[model samples]
Target chain A: MSAPHSATSANGVPTLDVARLREDFPILGQQINGRPLVYLDNAATSQKPVAVIDAIARYYREDNSNVHRGVHALSERATAAYEAARETVRGFLNAASSKEIIFTRGTTEAINLVAQAWGRSTLQPGDEVLITHMEHHSNIVPWQMVCEQTGATLRVAPINERGEVIMDEFERLLGERTKLVAVGHVSNALGTINPVARMIELAHAHEALALVDGAQATPHMVVDVQALGADFYALSGHKMFGPTGIGVLYGREALLDAMPPWQGGGDMIKAVSFEGTLYSDLPYKFEAGTPHIAGGVGLGAAVDYLAGVGREAIAAYEAELLAYTEARLQEVDGLRLIGTAENKAAVASFVLEGVHAHDLGTIVDHHGVAIRAGHHCAMPVMEFFGVAATSRASLAFYNTREEIDALVTALQDAQRIFG
Target chain B: MDLRDLYQDIIVDHNRSPRNFRRIDNATRMAQGYNPLCGDKLVIYITLKDGAISDVSFQGEGCAISTASASLMTEVLKGKTEAEAEALFDNMHRLLTEDAHGVDVDELGKLAALEGVRAYPTRVKCATLCWHTLQAALEEVDEPVTTE
Candidate 1:
């Protein structure tokens, strides 16, 4: 469900007031290259709204203290804010308990946490880790490293030309020896929203655990990890209009309790001594040392802001915008879209016939159109498409169709010069 | 800065039809260059005769800046001795990265058209990657030259 429902909200009003919402993001009002900035690089990292910025600043200004350590008033406030952020993330993902959510550096670290802590402890020499062709390097390399260290084999399922996982191939790759199945909830480079719900069911049927890379998906739609039955779901807050360096890893509570701590430090231990130390419980067992307290506060505000705007409304508006983008891009001469899956987020990756992707990126950038050009940390996808690179224009809910028109004009100007 | 200053007409022409864009069957030396940032790769081939570079060619896929830089490089370094070519690469380096007043333009010739790329700090690597590859070809390095 890209749109999930009709274009109207439950009250029959238009789902998203993008113009009013745009005002909250001050960066969107700026001018670059002597023109209005049409930011289309949300897939890399989104612009923060005033609420998130104020929350972070206010935390540092007033509640600046290490959490879970001090007994004073500021420490209590900091601890309260940090813990509440965890609860916010828990509710955002619809997890059973806040203990299931672990505050990590970002999605990359979250995946690495599972790969090192869970994979190293559970995997055996003959076990296998199954992943797809469309996975970002963060998902692929962590699993690869874990497999090498644990002597577990890594298997990759193939994707179709449309940059989608072939369900049949994916199922065929699963087996009794498959210990884990890692897949991206949405392809960052291609924007193909995968059928992760069905895939999780398939993985469970084979008695294998599943991890969903929800870094790209959480910014666009509501993620119910409980409903999806996902054993692990990793996401980055920066991609979802939160601050950088804060992300969440949602894992089943039982699975987390069984795993050893990935790192050792002050906050993660209950009793440290010359002898063996007793580790903390559940989430804190994994989060070691002094965490980014202010970042957590900011992320909480980001979650609150998105909840205020409504994820369903954001999804619907972006879906319509994506449709408009795809249609307008097709009108460009000698331009070809790379990912054409039936369902996708608001991401469009394409290559101009005469110009290299980097050239297009540089050209459009001069017109104040910011898009991503390169492998997008998905070299495997680039290899599959047989292209050196592709320019990607990823949109958020605040993006307007008029801004999309500006992108088209810049791209056309590039064509004229290169042609 | 203006986009025209970055994508000048001369650089555009060279990119559209690169010169010496071929692989030498048997060459004195060969080295591969890669811009991992952009997934751009190029191979520089050289042949020497009478203590001077007799032929030079390159084959690769990159942006207009990289392709034009490599194409124009081969055209200028055709008959220069090894030392002369090295000096020219140094000059090209200064021209792309240093202040304009610091560049000695005596030997830059038509290659000066690429001076437009100096305005873009990020694309500076695209303009200089070919020279690094050429430097590697003249040396004993076995691995590909990378602009990290």
Candidate 2:
């Protein structure tokens, strides 16, 4: 496959015009602590572009109504916009059909939907649900809940010191009894890109379904659910420069058709009565009630904006930024970078000598550099690394080398104060 | 908020070398506290003699603020009755959470070092993790305390 036009540079290196891209996000222009804001917490939630924000506001102002309920003009318009958003997300993940895409609150909700709907029905008492040590809490906790409810066992696939998944161990754990394999496409805490495609193949070999938590991966790369052949793929819209409270769950149509509805409410029902109620068809069977209409619209706009920028270009630019960030961070003495994986995204988690992540986070905030300081909702990874917390600077395409320099300077300031 | 105010010398000093930083044997009461946000875990133990806290200690891993707060709490808790310790906890809670303008710094003594925690809303939980565990220990609650 050829690189997108915006991704290719003269020297065969993929590059993005980050300066022009920065103009799209107005929040990046604001000042924090009397300095220009340097947002590097994209893993937490990305700053939305004007197009997405405007799309949401436009929906609320121009077409605010309950979707799929009323036959009126406003409701029809809102329903059209909401359904269009699903089509946009379907294209974003390159799913085979819109029927496979289910709108959810976020990745957490999407995972819960799958766990409760599919896991509860499918898992037996002795069944095992395999997950990695590097998965975010969203992926871990939902399966835990399912296991607790269904009397199934939860197995953990270990990661090496460099934070990459030990695939041999992963395959060893995937036995005939293993019912599901839930893994993150990218580690939010360590930025370790797991070998999920091969892992999925291994799961399929063992007759276990694979669910990819694509929250961290969707923003940084081009994800084709059909190409990956994943049983289920989840994404959070907010992490991909869309509004909060909206996400997508792409499941195989066959799997989705077999799984019962997760929630029973307004839109998920076909014909309801006191005696019985038939569930709706695929996608709607999972998305219950009047959904986050504006959020869906905003996510659709975000998809358009990302496509305009080109996902390949964004991924390439972020890869360069990650390298630049890692090199710059190394210049700071006594700094230890965590998660030294061969394959990584634009996340840099580190700890400075004699400085707590919390202290570093505070000091850096004063310098107007936003970083995530804590376990990054991956405590198992922290325990594995033998640290309480690590300060993380996660990047987006809008971030520049200068912002990384600012982050390094802030770390130096932290060293000066705590040294 | 000034960073110096939060990471005052006393707090930093106590963090470097915490007092009563050990696991107590034959404790009258004990409890575990966990702050899931930052992964701060601490176990608080107290020995009571004739209705007074004869000795107190803690062991765990946490950030500087949490470690120092735990250390300071252990120091002040010794030689105080359960009622007095509870009152002191209330005072510390107010001092750490509320405005320091009207609070008597002299009464707070070394604990005033943690007064800057109120400025960082997120860190307030870190500073108080041990105190909550201490409360749990005093009440003899078997379940672990968590700052969720």
Candidate 3:
């Protein structure tokens, strides 16, 4: 059974302590366009807290050295810190060990790694890779590349107009020919939190591995990879309030052992003598270089910050904000909420009949509210919903109800201009 | 929502009662332009009368700025010769992209409805998609079309 809770912590309520969270993030107190900055673009790249920033700065200042080969004190310290970060990530995702976690540039690169490494080796001609229609382009394009290269087929599982995956149809799409089923744990464009655990189970039942793109889900909710039974999972550090150029790709140990190294380079080699070198073990086999040491440390700090704030707290607060936001947004004449999925994160995507999403974003920005506009890198989702684009206001723990009110007021003015 | 600064009264009026939002039967040269970024598409139908643009119409789906821009573009180039139409297209592009071009804003004609597009960096492409398609149709015409 699912956890019997209202997405709240054991305190029976979500305790965000917004004032405390705000203090951790220095960027929150700044002014932009003559108004207090209301950062609603968390899904894109969340603002970093002081701890994560300091972690990155400290690593470069004191622990700046190449890892794995260093015997000196500073290099040893840097290597320890890098590996410690990997351990933190392993713990965060509930993976068996740190060996299963491979660091990459971001979720895009993480997905691409699996596509090139495991996908190339396993997928046969006429094999099918199942993905949802609402997948972000990162999830979609990598699978497309793999299919193109391996002569495999890419099958799209359709979602209902409400943005929920048609479970019956999804189950029907899976078969013996299905080599892999890749799906997003949450829809970045629509904020639909998919039931990936069930989907993963279904894929495994069909004898196919499942890769969950947790770029959107990881930041907003608790992600237990083992609980979800995901064979592979990917997440970006930037979305988790960490530095850019850092992400995690967690694959089953057996799968990682079987898959070839994506890039053959210095560290990935077991014994390089120009004759044919054996590849390194899991995790390092995929890393292949002096990894983003500082970035990984920063990501560890970010994960710590989120844990401190509590994911359940953030999820509950954002859910309340989304509820209020939806009600307020619906009050505006001619305004329509695009995605009404039963399970959604705090994102509110809407279209104001005559006003374009791009125009709405510009007008709202004038009020110091920064929201995302356009396809949001999910072009197929936009095409599915029959909208050119939408103005998306994605929320985080620091976002307040008052900021949502400001968004509503700004959107109301948008109606007057477009009308 | 500073209507006077961005969405002028002219823009709202033109958006409400669009001048030319119909299809042209047997249009000599018809082509469609799409701004995939914003999902704006415009299908331009042009009919030349003795090497001059006699009838021009458009029908497609887009936001207010793009649709009104399309509607206004059809109205602006209806009576003008091919050369005048081409010059107007250039002026519109300059106006949208480099608003500081000193091309008198008065010359914007009905296309002035899209001046709000200048404030919006992203939608500038939506405003220009129709004008670009019109220019494409003009370029296709053989034998230098009559100038104003």
TM-score of chain B of each: 0.96, 0.95, 0.84
Candidate 3 chain A vs. true chain A: TM-score? Answer: 0.96
State the C-alpha lDDT per candidate: 0.93, 0.91, 0.85
Summarize candidate 2's per-residue lDDT along A1-419 as a digit string, tens digits: 12333556788766777777788899899999899999999999999988899999999999999999999999999999999999999999899999999999999999999999999999989999999999999999999999999999999999999999998899999999999999999999999998889999999999999999999999989999888989999999999999999999999999999998888999999999999999999889998888999999999999988898888888888898899999999999999999999999989999898889988888899999999999898989999999989999999999999999999999998887766
lDDT of 2: 0.91
lDDT of 1 at B121: 85
Candidate 2, residues B1-148: lDDT per residue as tens digits?
5778888888878888999999889999999998777778899999999999999999998888999999999998889999988888888888878877777778777887888899888888888899999999999999889866
Q: Calculate DockQ per candidate and list them.
A: 0.86, 0.61, 0.49
Which regions of candidate 1 deviate over 4 angstroms? A1-14
Q: Write the per-residue lDDT of candidate 3 for residues A249-356, one digit (tens) a residue.
A: 999899898888899887787788867888888778998878888999999998887877777877778888889888888888888888899999978888888777
Instruction: List TM-score per model, in order.
Output: 0.98, 0.94, 0.92
Summarize candidate 1's per-residue lDDT along B22-108 as a digit string, tens digits: 999898989999988898899999998887889999999999999999999999999899899999998898888888786778679
Predicted candidate 1 versus true structure: per-residue lDDT over A1-419, tens digit per residue: 12322247576655877777888899999898888999999999999999999999999999999999989999999999999999999999999999999999999999999999999999999999999999999999999999999999999999999988999999999999999999999999999999999999999999999999999999999999999999999999999999999999999999999999999998999999998999999889999999999999999999989888888888878999999999999999999999999989989999999989989998888899999999999999999999989999999999999999999999999998888
Off by over 4 Å in 2: A1-7, B50-52, B146-148
Local lDDT at A30 for model 3: 86
Error of 1 at B67 (Å): 0.4
Q: Model 1 residue A244 lDDT?
A: 96
Mark the regions of model 3 whose C-alpha exceeds 4 Å error after superposition: A1-11, B1-3, B99-101, B112-116, B141-148
Question: What is the Cα-based TM-score of model 3?
Answer: 0.92
